[model samples]
Target: MARYELVKRSVALITLTNPPVNALSSAVRHAIAKSMEHALNDPKVSAVVICGENGRFCGGADIREFAGPLRGPPLVPLLDAIEAGEKPVVAAIEGVALGGGFELALVCHYRIAHFKARLGLPEVTLGILPAAGGTQRLPRLIGIPAALELITTGRHISAQEALKLGIVDQVTEQNACEVAVEFALRAVAKPLSSRRVSMLTTPCPPDLDALLEAVTMQVKKKARGVMAPLACIQAVRAAATMPYSKGIKRESELMATLFNSGQARALQYCFFAQRTAGKWTLPSGAQWNNSKPREIRSAAIIGLGTMGRGIVVSLARVGISVIAVESEKKLLETGKQMVIGMLERDAKRRGVSASLNLLKFTLSLQDLKDVDLVIEAVFEDMALKKRVFQELSKVCRPATLLCTNTSGLDVDALAGVTDRPHLVVGMHFFSPAHVMKLLEVVCGPRSSSETIATAMSLGKRMGKVSVAVGNCPGFVGNRMLKPYLDQATFLLEEGATPEQIDKALEDFGFAMGVFRMSDLAGLDVGWRVRKESGLTGPDVDPKNPPRRRQGRRYCPIPDMVCEQGRFGQKTGRGWYMYDKPGGTNAKPDPLIQNLLEMYRSRYGIQPRNISDQEIIERCLFALANEGFRILEDGIAARPEDIDVIYLFGYGFPRHGGGPMFYSSMVGLERVLERLEHYHQAHPDVPHLEPSPLLKKLVACGSPPVQKWREHIKTMHSHL
Candidate 1:
């Protein structure tokens, strides 16, 4: 819907009137066309100004429309008509002009942007190119190289950057609509031929082919199996080599190729899934909408290790005063210096002064007594955590919230040690908390809705994709990781090398394979967990079979690697050997191959060649199978939450959706059949067995991932 008015007596002002981010829906598109027609036909109209009703210009096309057949006037022809109109049209950009919105601005003869405005063609992020003459017009307005980079990456630019790139004619701090009207009025007396971007020749570089080829390699290397960036590259090439008419047709052809693709569907699903994950709902009917979160002005962090330092930085950067605690004076000083340096570097990159003044490092728990919230980021030992909680209960005020940054411990057990159990929740920030976007708010049985809301709200304030999950060992992301890691280790015992398995997964779109990720994460962490759980070391029964643990087939290869002091990158060795201690580059060591051969010989097991298909099916299917169990257990409210966790926390490829969605994409029937087949072949491996939820879903015709919650009975929900 658009509202049209005559401003300055001669200029027709057409404002898009959709709420929030004025997305171009069918109705809005129809209104835009009609408004432009009237403006062109009106005798009094010398020029026209287009802007959104709210501060936001437009986000993009209404992505909800992508689910159905397109209606109303097609965007390309409508945009072309606007460009061809004899009356000069000016775009007034304020908040954002993305995808179709950015394309809409391109057709206008002039663009005036507010200082805070952001602009980009972000269709490639949804696995499609900018199809509404964007590919053709942008290169003509700016050069081919700049257009190619913006289109392929979907990176947004500020108004200053837009002005520097020549995308906008003027940038002002005043009302963009008013400035645009004045700009249009002045442009009415000038020739329109030069202002029409489509009529301009694209400035192609001399080494166009080489530049395109280099960008192609870069995109392929960065995104792996992604298709949209490559398609975008082809469209940009068309713009550089062909006339506007041909280039526009080529852009449409490229968009058609990507529009209905599976990759596009997965990426689009991910877009919606992130939004759905935030709408957390508890069984008591306390949800995101109803629950009120307390404002956290100041917080305390117990311990100043890697996670603690990052958490301190995260809190401080968001203008929340942070008091970081350590056990000793020496440790406190070390953490203080490290945190300051990290914050300084981060602030430098963001073009802001470091918020170091807000940070306070201390060796006393008494320093945290007055803080609004206290996050325990000490070691993962349960006893150590309980002691810390008990001390906090004695020291802190009754109203202060208590949170744990535990990766995979029982929140209820920790909550039991505190006087304010209802205030205790788990804020599981992934490693390097200052950088990673995920923050799993683990809601214990005793956690109050306000506590959960506050944790979720604080995570959002720190620019995190926070999902509220039910309390369980390892919560949602790490709990499901057990079976996935198990399957990868089992593949090694079956004669598949680490590189082979990793390659199979990497080719499937993972940024890094399991073994490579393990190396980076430090293999000793899991080894310590295994040792404490009595799965390995002296606690294991000597009478128990070496390859068996707790009545299930287990791989002790990781323990063996740890026995050799191959902790991971820190020690320069893990599944693969690094060049030196603290080195990142991993290479397959002959010593590991020899170890594998000896282990196989001692066990009298035959090594068989494994296919990439088997590796992917076994690892990923096992991962999804655990997700099904998590859903049935009520650990995650919906498939979207699980997917979002994997996407943001575990580096799950965006184009593959998440494990739950990927399982649905693979067909539940196929997953169940494969899981059953694997279970039959290895009766000793219980994880290979299909979960009840998977079988139930398969029996019920395997509805889409969004509909999975309906089938799950929440009678035994933990949240």
Candidate 2:
């Protein structure tokens, strides 16, 4: 509904009403146009001021509407109505005014924004251009160069920056509506002829052609396979050449093309799925809505290794004061330097500095005295971690929340050592915590609702998508990864070369192939862990069959590579040959080929040709099967949560909509059949057993992933 109120001195205030993110739907668009009509008809209304119901003006067009059929009023008509409004109009911008929302403000005669307001035409990020006159009108108001840059990149600028760029007319400290009303009143008697933006011509510079050519080249380079960037360029060119109405028509045509593209659907799904991922539910019946978070004013980090250093940077980035602890003086000094260097780089990037140090490095657990949260990020030894948590429990405040930064450990057992068992949880951060946007928040058996809520809240504050999962061996991400990684190893045993597997998955849109990624991450990392676990070491029986473990399949290829000192890029060789240690150039090596042939002969294994399609199906379906199991157990609340974790945590392509969404698109029945076929071929593999939930769903004419849980609920009722 449109919220309309009259301020003092005959000023009409029209605010856009929406919750969460103010996504402008067709209904809201119609209301805005109707409000303008009412104001135009009423002589009592001297001037009009437009704002939003919430702090945010809008996040653009209803992204939800972009997925399915178009069912709402076009925002363009409403924008045109505002431009043609008879009464003087001013736009009151607060929070974010983006995409069509910013285009609405562009139609107003004057714009007044709060200092904290952010404004942009950010449709480009979602693989679309601003269709509601943003490309055309912006160029007419600002110059072509500035408008092109803003429209193409879709980066939001601050109110202060927008004012300087002449995108907004004024920046104010008072309420945006009050300033807008004052501006409207002041502009009432002024000539409306020059204020008509549509009637104006875009200022063309002498270097316009060169600028356009450069922008086109850059967009083509960056976008690669996307269609929207090129279309955006064409719309901007139309704005430069055609009349306002014709340019708008060109914009609409391009928008229609993007609206119908599969990329658009995928991108929009990516947006909503990301928001949904943060709302977690557990098997224990504790949900995101039911949880309450305690505020953490200060925090502590134990260990200053690579992971710990990144964690320190992440905490400081979110304005949390951190007391980083290390056991030794030398390691503490090294960590302090690394943390300071990273923070300095961050400050340089953001163009901001702090007089107060947000991070402190010390060698004692005594430094964690006043902190509310303490993160243990030492070596992955259970005894050491238990000891650290026990000591921290005694030293830190009783209310302090203890977190273990373990990739794959028992959070419940770790909590057992702590005095405050309810306050301990797992904050499994992805590699390079400051950079990656996914945090797998693992809840222990005794972890309280407040602990889970606080960790989720902290993840959001650090710009991470937090997914809550039960305490399994590897929780969600890595647990599902086990099968996928196993498939890659199986491919090697089945005669598929490392390059062939990597290239196939890379073609499927992964940024890097499996072997290439392993090489980059250092093969020795996994080798040492496997050796420590007795998966491959001196403790193994000599009678154990080669390339097999526990009567199931296993691959010791990584172990072999480590044994030979070919420990990935650091050694200039692993799966592929590099130019030198730490060099970027990678090429096939005859030495590795010789090693493969020798190993195959020693094991009496035969090499056979494997197709790329076969490789992709096996690995991806294996992971998807595990995802179904995760869903059945209620470890993940929704299919989109699985997709979100993969997209943000792993580099699962956004356009593919994660592993589960991709499997759904491929048809569940088909995926189940593939899994069954693979299971028959390898009867010893227990994880390959088809999940009962998946079989039932397929038997029942497998519905969309969103409705699977409802079916599960109904089945349980029958039981």
Candidate 3:
């Protein structure tokens, strides 16, 4: 609803009253339409000022309403009436003016924005273009190029930037409504013809066709499988090429195409999935809403390798004083140099001074004794981590929270080493932690609800999308990765080349294929893990069998590659060959192809040409099947958490909605059939076998992804 009052007796002030964000709900839209009519018809009212209750103007058209049929007054007509009204209308924008909210502002005769206000047309992010005259009117107001950028990327801009872009009439430090009301009073006498945005001509560039083509190519490369950005470009083109009426019609047509798309549904699900991932729950009933997190002002990081240096920078940049430790003076100096350089470069990008004063590098573990928390980022070896934890127990205060930055290690095993097991959790950060958005807060069996909350809160403070996963080997994200990688290597053994497999994955919307990503991450890391696990190397039972490890099928190809000093990009050759050490451009090596041929010949196995469909089905379905196993085992509470992990950490395409959601979209029955088919073909590969949960769900009519937790909750929870 909307509250109407006569400010200064002559100017009618209409304030939207939907709480929190004052989103344009059906009632609010109807109220605005009624208020506008009253203000326009009344002889006493000379002008109108539109604003929202509280600080926020509007978030957008009620996204909740998007799920159902179009109801209430349509936005396009409501907005058109406001723009065509005889009386002068001013928009007072604060907090956020996004999607339909920004579109509403464009129709007003004048816009006054608070200095802290953010504005943008962000419909494309939800996989729909702004269809309520936004595409047509914005280009007419600020020209085509700027409008295209704003609509396509959904990037919010500061009030100062909006002013520079000519999106707002004035920027103010005072209450936006007061400024807009006063400005509206003076605008009543001005010529309304010049202020009407729809009447204005769009500023078309000379190389408009070429400029559009360039953006199209960039969109295809950067966001390969997404459709909204492409539709947005078409809408903008219509605005530049046609009249306002025709452009608005074209914009609606484009929105219709994108609105009902599966991509839109996936994107919208992702928008909420991110919010849901943060709401961590435990079997003991301790959860996000009830658990209070401790305030962390200072922290420490042990070791100064790539992960450690990044962790140090992440803590220090967030105003948390960081104490970085190294085993030796020489190692400490090297880490210090790298940390300082990364911080400076990051600061320059964000236009802030590097927080050098918050950082302290030392060669002693004793320096970390007084810190509130300590994160161990040393080697991934259990013995080494246990020793480090035991030392920290002896040195640090009893109340200190201890964390380890391990991707796939046992948090419980690490917890057993610490005196305060309840406070020992895992804060797994992706490489270059200062940059990656994901932080999997691994909740151990003994980790207190308060401890988990603190880790999750701290990660959020450092600009990370943290998800609390159960303490298990590899946790949620990496735990599911094992089976997926196995299927990929199996394909290589069955005649598909690395490039062909990688192409299938890349075409499916993954930013990097498995082999290429392994090369970038260094092949030796997994090689060491495999060696430690007795899967390969000197510790393995070489006399037993060549391709069988314990009871399951094993691939020794990665181990062989590492044995030859081919440690990926760092060593110049892996699955693909680089130009030199540290080079990035990967070229398929004939040596790898020849090696594969010889290995197949030695095994006396006949190879067949594999179809792209098989590559995608095996790689992706196997990935989802493991996700089901993880859920059944309670390592991941819900499919959303698993999806969020992939989206932020492993470069899983957002349009696919992670593997679990993708499986649901593919139909649980179809996935079950595919897994059965593959497993029947390769009985040696246990990963290809369908998870019992997948079969159970298929038999039970395959409830949607959101409903999967009901079945998973009945099983024992690892959290």
Candidate 4:
């Protein structure tokens, strides 16, 4: 509801009352309409000042209302009445003015924002456009070029930037409401024609077509197949070519098309999935709120390699004093220097001094005695990690939490070796940890909820989207990646080329395809893991079939590539060729093609024609198949947990949601049928077989992704 009263006996100050973000829900809209009517009718109220309770202007049209029928006052006409009022009106912006919130401010005669306020028309991110005259008015206020960028990107800008772009009239240090009230009083007698944004002419560029063409190409390249950004470009084009009234109609028409799209439903589901992902639960009655995380002021890191250095930078930047430990003096110095450089560069980009003083480097385990927590980011070897944990148990304080930065090693095994197993957990930070947003908190059975909570809270402090997952061979992300990666290699053995497989996946909206990603991540990593597992090398039984491992089909192409010392970008060749060692450019190597041909011939396998659709189906279905298995095993709390991991840790397209969500969007019944068909065709490829949970869900009429957990909740939870 809107609270309206006269201020200074002349100015009528109407405050929008909504907690958190003042979203323009139906009731709030009705109240705002009534307040505006009362203010316009009162002869004593000379000017109007509109603001939001709790220091927020508005958060745009309540998106929750989007799924329902139109009710109460519509936003466009309500805003039009606010603008067409006889008395001057000022918008007092504070906290955030986003989506419909920002649109409300645009309709005001003047906008006065708090110095730290953030404002943006972020409807594009939600798969919609600014339908309430935002498309028409923003271009007129800030010219087409600037408005186009903001509306298309859906990025929030600071109050200073808003003032610079002429989106807000003033940035004030004083209370925005008071400032806006005074400004409204002064503008009461001025001609309202100039203040009306709808009547203003948009400043058109001479090369309007060229600008639109360039932005169109850029958005297509960046967004790949998303629809909202493309519609934003068209709406801005309408503002430039047509009048405000017609432009608004075009904007509404575009919004209608987007609102009905499946992409809109997927994006909105992701928004809520992210929120729910943070609220983790356990079968043992431990939950997010019940478990308390200890505040970490000082921490220690063992191993100063790439992962360790990134972790150090992540910790020190957040004002946590970090002691980075290495076993050798030379390696410690090298890691220290690299860490310092990364921190300096990061601070320079953020316009702040590097927190190098908070860092401590040492070559002894004794140095971590007093630290609150110790994260061992050593190599991904179980015995080596156990040794580190054993040492940490003896060296660190009993109250300290021990964390392992292993990608897929057994967290429970490491926990078993320590005296404080209940206090140990996995903080699987991705490579280049400071840049990536995902962190998988691996919770072993022995791991206490407080330990898991602490690890999660610390990851969040480092600006990561942390998901608490059950301990397994590869946790959630890496475990599912095996089948996906295997499918790509198997496709190659059949007939698919590296480029063909990559292009299909790229067109499907991955940042990079499987082989390209492997090349970038270095092929040697997986090769080492496979060799250690006795899938290849001298440890394999001589009687074992060359194409089979543990009674399942195995592809020896990757091992053969590794034998040639083609360890990806580091060695200049793996799945693709680079210009030099460590170079990023990936060119298809004819040598790899020859290698595939000879291997297929030696195995007496006939080459088959592989379609792009088959490549997509084999790779993605296998990937989602593992996700189903993970759900069955209770490794992930829900399908959204897996989706969140892909959305952040992996480059899963936002419009498709994550693989689990994508599978649901594609229809679970269809996924189960395809898996059954593919598994029947390739009997040895067990990963292609659908999990029982998938079949069970399909049997139950294939419920939506959100409801899958309820059915699965009847089964035992792993985490």
Candidate 5:
């Protein structure tokens, strides 16, 4: 795990040999401890330089070891021994030094970082504080304020930033190991007392109490119920007030508190879940590692609306030439300017020149004839999409792949319109595609494995967390949204106001409640979808009872709101009122409250009190219930894929895991019972009923979310 040798006849070079990120596994830690001992005991060694073999410094603790018992020398004492060594020890940081790795660098007498290197104490992100003298040493090296920000946020800083903050002694453009070795040679005769960070007094601000209080408030407000940041703040406070010995104890205590916490487990599960989501698989045995993805040098986007414009920016920034199409000349010009401005601003932020020269805007399909792939981002109408695909089949070459940016429309139906049904797939990019990290690669029944692979790879290139999902209405993210949204509206009808319900969900860790999210997303979108489905408006049979559509109970409240031209933020009114059209600040509107009261009176139904618990159970349980059904239906391959979609596409809280994991954490038996109770109470609502998969899992002893795919193996698979 580690290699040691003498260089310059006086300096010992210790290089960590672990491949990839050189995570501090038990073996690697043992190796490091032994190597340090040899360097310190050797009479000829005057100095030591430590670095990773493959340019990357340690990424952090081996998370795989987290589930096992500690088997090697403990990190804290090992790091302390190195810090107290008689020989000067220098850390040569190259690609990254994070978490325990950053802690490793902290204990060294000196640090030299490559200009492109990154460093951070990101233990807080995993629901733990830095336990290896990081909280104590960092506050002493940098001031309390800067240390608090870095430790609390777990944000990585550039080598230059590390230099400015005194985290690293120097940043070099050349090889960091060479620079560190030279630095270690010159430091052999220097006093080591001042070089030891833990010995330095923490730079205290005058208003220490107030500053700590302010940061505490900010953390609480931003993260809500998250525990790690709060613990990090407390650790930093200890470093500011207590001796190093006491401060480090406090840090360890904080880490212990977080290490076993459910929140910590959830965060760690999320970390792995994100990585697992990338390894897509199909029933045909074609998977991520085996399937070959075609190289996309150039692509075309149909329609130049919000989604299309964002798609263009996403492609151009990644060095792929994009041809954006529009039906009208005026719309084409407007989209052209928007795409250019967005690309330029994005480039400015990234410190790179805009790739605007790669973009082509036109009102003709002929411009896309030679493109490698064509993503139709027109309106989410199947007929319109079909027409576009038909046109593309005629315009583009036979080998070109065709993709649709439809959120819920049928991918196979659109495939049927093209000559290449096997090439047609869904690239469902979330709104503001350039910013959102999620892309659902909807694999149609006819979609070839190669086509799916290409879309997934392209999504990765665009900096998206793409999950390959089977073709179905709404795919994974939005398909499950139906029940969730239904439960929220039903609560509103049962006397819970929008604010009350939104408050309950937001307190439950959702960034926004259903109603508030709907307002911002534009209520007209769902309203139009409902109308098109004949659930409301002229298409509905007048013979059917009011508030009842087909066989199940329906909420006409949204339709009524839309009828009044309330289309959410864009119209300055929806479930809540805004200051003006295009405004964001949403306040409860009296008009909505009055409408609800009149609707209740007209139906001769009594309004009842609804508890926050009921709101959460009904809404979230319904969401998870749909996820179980999706799993049973084989639309999603695993619970993790569904969770990833929610995490990246939707704003599911990280600490709670995703809906599927949350359901498992809540205990499947309890979920099934609650769902059964809800179903009995509201017999007219089908969504409240527990799915068979949930019942099966509960009967099978409610295994962990990770084990769910084993049970789902017998079910028919779409991907």
Candidate 6:
């Protein structure tokens, strides 16, 4: 709810009283419109001032509304009312003023923003355009080019940047509400007609045709497979051609079209999925709401390899003081240089200053004595990690937090070597940590809530989306990834070639297919892990199947490749041929094709041409099946959590709404039927076995892709 008070100073204050982002729902919108009407009629109220009760102006339209029937007053009419007001209105923007919130500001005659304010018409990012006359009025106010950039990209602008772009009239340090009120009172005498943006024509570039073509090309390049960007372009085009009312009509039509798109649902799923990931819980009953993160004014990192260097950069970029530990003096110097070089490159790329408040490098453990937290990224061997943690527990303060950078090791064992077991946790950063946005935070059994909170906070500070997970071998992301990788390898062992499988997944919307991603990451990484686990090489059991290692499904194709010294791009050969060792350029390899044929013949397997559809269904459905199992076991708290992990960590196509969501879209019955078909075709492949939860849902007549979880909830109650 919102209200308007007519102060004696000739300023009417319109306050959005709703808490938690004041997401302009129907009631809020109605209140705002009524307040504007009241302000317009009062003769004494010469001007109006608008601000939110809480720090945020608004997040956007209530996403919750998208789930239900839409029955609300259109926001355009309110904008029209605001624009046609007898006196000037000043918007006092603080926190985030987004979507219709920002559109409301555009309707105002003047805007004043606090320094911390972030404003944007971010509807395009949510797979919708600003239907509240934003596309129409923004172009009229800022010209076509600027308006197109703002609406098309939906990028948030700071108060300083907003002023520079002429999006805001002024930025102030004083109370934004009070300042806006003063400005509103001062602007009463100014001509309101000239200040109204809707009255002005959108100024198009002289080369209008060329501009249109450029925008089309840019949208095609950047927003492939998305509907919102294209719709936004069409709306902007209407702005240039039609009158204001007609242009608004076109915008509304475009909004309706995008609102029904699967892409819109997927994009919104991504938004809420990210928020859901923050609401993590552990088996011990600790949750995000109850945890308190300890402040880390200073931090330290052990070792200075590529992973270590990136860790240093991540910490330093977030303005944390880091003491980098390296036993080798020469290597330590090299690590220091790499850290600085990376930071410099990052600063130059972002077009920002390179001066981090407290980014430091050191070669001594004594330097970690006073630091609040330490992340050990030494070689992944258990012996070395244990020794480091043991020495760290002794040298560092007892209260200091300790983290391990192991991707697949036992976090519990790592913490066992430390005196302060409660302070130990796993912070697994993907390679090139400074750039990659996903951080899998693993909580050891004994890890305190504070440790979990601190690690999650650190991930946030380093610009990573952290997913708190219980400590399993590979945690959530990598553990689930195993089944998908196994399926790809099994496909190779069967009649399919690497190129065929890769092509199938690529067509399905992964940026790269499984084989291509493996090659780029260096196939040796997985090979080394497998070898260490005794799944291949001298440790293999004599009675094991040639292609299959255990009674369960297994593929030795990757192990076979490793045996040939084909370590992917590093060796110029893997699933595909490369130009040279460590080269990026990969092409279809006739050698790999012949090798696959030979293996198939040797194994008495017929090499029938596999269709792309088979490849797509097998890989995706296998991953999706595992997702259902995860949900049943509560390994993932919700279906949305799985989506967040896949979107951020595994590059699952966002438009498809991650694997679990896509599965839901495909319908549980369909997924179950497909699994049955595959299982019958290959009875020996036990991993093809569908989760019982999936079967129960299908049996209950609940579609797999939709409303599967509702069935599970009802069944769980009986259990």
Candidate 1: stretches off by over 4 Å: 713-715
Candidate 2 stretches greater than 4 Å from native = 8-10, 143-145, 204-224, 283-285, 354-356, 493-500, 569-572, 577-590, 600-609, 677-689, 712-719
lDDT per residue as tens, model 4, 1-719: 88989999999899999776889999999999999999999999999999999888888888888878999999999998999888899999999999888989998999999998999988888888899999999999999999999999999999999999999999999999998988988998898999999999999999999999999999999989999999999999999999988999998999899997888988888887888888888898989999999999999999999899999999999999999999898999899999999999999999999999999999999989999999999988888999999999999999999999999999999999999999999999987888989999999989998998899899889999999999999999999999998899899999889999999998888888888888888888899999899899989988888899989999999999999999998999988999999999999999999998999999998989999988988888899999998988989998889999998987888888889888888999898888889999899999998988889999999899989988888777889
**Every candidate's lDDT:** 0.93, 0.83, 0.91, 0.91, 0.93, 0.83
RMSD of candidate 2 to the truth, in angstroms, is: 3.1
Tens digits of lDDT, candidate 3, 1-719: 89999889899999999987888999989999999999999999999999988899989999878889987899999999999999999999999898889989998999999999999988888999999999999999998889888988999999999999999999999999999989998998988988889899999999999989998898888898889999999999999999999999999989899888888888888988999999999989999999999999999999999999999998889899999999999999999999999999999999999999999988888887888999999998889999999999999999899999988889999999889999999999998788899999999899999999999999999999999898878888887888888888888888989999999899989999999998999999888889888898777786757688988788777787788899988999999999999999999999999989998998876889999999999989999999999899888889999999999999888988899899998899999999999999889889889999999899889999999887777899877
Worst 10 residues of 3 by lDDT: 537-546
For model 6, residues 90-209, the per-residue Cα lDDT tens digits are 899999889989988888899999999999888887889999899998888778888888899999989998898888999998889888888887897888887888888888888877
Q: What tens-digit string does per-residue lDDT give for candidate 5 at 72-109? A: 99999999999999899999999999999999999999
Q: Show model 4 residue runs off by greater than 4 Å.
A: none
Task: Name the TM-score of candidate 1.
Answer: 0.99
Give candidate 3's error at residue 33 in angstroms: 1.9
RMSD of 6: 2.9
Poorest 10 consecutive residues of model 2 by lDDT? 710-719
Quickly count the clashes in candidate 1: 1
> What TM-score, computed on C-alpha atoms, does each candidate reach?
0.99, 0.92, 0.98, 0.98, 0.98, 0.93
Model 5 weakest lDDT span, ten residues long: 62-71
lDDT of 6 at 100: 88
lDDT of 5 at 412: 94
Q: What TM-score, to 2 decimals, does candidate 6 have?
A: 0.93
Minimum summed lDDT over a 10-residue window in model 4 is located at 709-718
**How does model 3 fare in lDDT?**
0.91
